[model samples]
Target: MGNTQIGHTDFMSKVRLTDRYVASVSPPPGGRIEIFDDNPLGAGLILRVSQTGRKSWVVRYRNEDGEQRRFSLGLYPDVSLAEARKRCIQARLAASDGVDPAGAKRRRISERRSRIIKTFNDLSLVYFAASECGEWKPRGKRKRPSTISGEKWLWTKHIKPSLGALPLEDVTPLDIKNLLRGLVDKGQDTSANRVRAQIRQMFNYAILEAEVATANPVARVPMMGEETPRDRVLRDEEIRLVWRALGDPGSLTSAQGARRANQRVYVSRPVALAIKLLLLTLQRRHEVAGMLRTELDLDQAIWAIPGSRTKNGRTTFVPLSPGAVVLIREAIRLADAGRDHPSAFVFPARWDRDKALTPASLTRALRDVSKALFLPSLTPHDLRRTAASHMASERLGISPLVIGRILNHTSEKGGAAAVTLSTYALHDFMPEKRSALIRWDKLLSEIVSTRL
Candidate 1:
């Protein structure tokens, strides 16, 4: 080869390229210089050193049309001397095969840029947005906001830290297994299972809707732990303890007396009222947490939860007991007092009144106070179960069917009975539900009133 000059300077030199030689070369003062690699392995490779001291690898070749073209291999030190040579040989072979290597390189880059979801995080955003818009639900159905919120929480807390930055196609079953195993090892077996389910659903969404992933990595992965149906029912004594810990009116009076003697109230008033309402009404945590002022008619003692907010996509009318009514009134007062404007939700979030209190926040509050109270470790759902169990006991003598109605549970029965209940039984059972909850309130009053 011959030296090529540009801009009144010799800008080309021929040499056998080595890592040591490339590192020792200094940048030109004015114009860029190209160091041609004379080694047979890197016949058309050139090390382009600009006047700004930046170094990069370039491959010069002639296509089938006898057209000279240059393609950038990558920056030096990052794409090292040996890697540059390997890429140069590949580029030359492509050129000799009557292919325009520069065009091919540009096509590959353009294809990559055209992909909307490059990483797991990108895929998750698309999945969540689609879910919120009801695109993922069955015909005429919608996804629950709480379900979306819980999935997002799982992604942000558990999955995102491990796989969010990974390319969509790069997440393997082994990576998913390791993540679940880590959670299982920490004794979070249920959480591990939940994480696994969320990840599997996300990848399925990607495959069906986004067309990003070809296969679900979580498909072959087994469940990390056994999840039994939870049948936890807090005993009457435990219920009393929890009710007191929640700072009910009786508990608050005592807390205030303690505060006069320098004691602190750990439970917030709004959350306490919400939890009490959960036990009194036997409603789902999310449904109660997202209770809107418009959904209630205090005069008629009815709380009409819309189909949009429910799990089974059926509207439910819950009869609020006298106690539940009082609690709702107090929560509304607190909600109005906490913000500059009136909140639409009965249980408004503490930080942002425009939104309702999150179901996760309700769970967290119960978890923390339960631990502090040294009571049996229980969840908010356990409180609902406790109420249903006691109402079914010989003391209250409420039937399972009535309790199920109060809980707004969809009928799992099949055949004619299912059709009868689902299609014909259009009655809201307001009267029956009201009587059951009133009996429950009477029994609960006696239970919480007893001296522990």
Candidate 2:
């Protein structure tokens, strides 16, 4: 074989050897012929450097079965001298143990990185109800589904749309930043914050249960926490206006206003009485809405609400004041007048006589009242806030707990809702909360009595 020199002599790359080994370049390229001991049959290893500069090691040995075994230690100096030796050792050990060294190496590499990338698209396919460019968001039950529905919308509309395409592993800090920045740019601050919260929950699920290694993408997302608190309560004068607007036979807005303006606001006689009961007893809108006519004992001045209708998932009873008794009796009288439809509710729906007006109906009625002011943009929750504020300001020494109890609101300090209808027992916190309500009614009465 003719010899050809590689670039530099100092590197000792060009081979000069005798014919038994023939350590010449294989071609014009950098082929390494066998580098061996002086004799080809020596007991050491041989290295062959290829034209591509890859060097592999081969050892010639005799197996215990008296067969010849030759092992290739793999291409290198990329593999390194130490790594080649390690591979040789592993190959020798595997051959001795009757394991295929090549197969073992492949298995080790496959086990280390066996996971495939999981995109949000995969998780969403199982969870999502719609496919507006691949998201896992559920559809709205209706045009409106109580206040919780709005929270759900915030999660689906903003957060799910933004980061719902990235693979769980690819969702880095920068990805989260970009998503939130895009939301802020669109002036959806409140919605952006809500989306951030929901995304954080998704990432948390991904980490703990889904076995994805990404940290919560929204862990560091900033919030423009409330800088201005919008007032939702009806002021003293506005309370008077709401009462004045009640009972006024004009538009539904006017009629609803008159009813909501004061506590005794309702069009249907039974519904009117229910409102009166809500005011006198300070019972929640649902407790009064869901009351079966049978649950009321007018003679005993008591109303029993079953646990199924209660928010706290418990049975509670409420003592009816004289005012409460008067209201329910009036409702019964009106409901009795509809004897042709015995199944008719106390506040029967105009569209469906079998169903009682929903608890939401009262709030909707108040919104109608606000619409009389050509839509002042007040919400029904504002009315509840008004009730609380009025109790705090005017009711005689009423505790915040009493307000919570009457409203069936869960106590902020504790998990208990003070006045839920879970118990079949007749006596409950109604006496205390009712007393507070009656006091509130008197204040409202005083304002409305002036006809201002």
- Each candidate's lDDT (Cα)? 0.84, 0.55
Q: Which regions of candidate 1 deviate over 4 angstroms?
A: 1-114, 138-140, 248-265, 338-340, 450-452
List model 2 lDDT by residue over 363-430, tens digit each: 55656655664446565456566767777874466888667766666545523432343332134566
lDDT of 1: 0.84
Ten consecutive residues with minimal summed lDDT in candidate 2? 138-147
Best by lDDT: 1
Model 1 — TM-score against the truth? 0.70
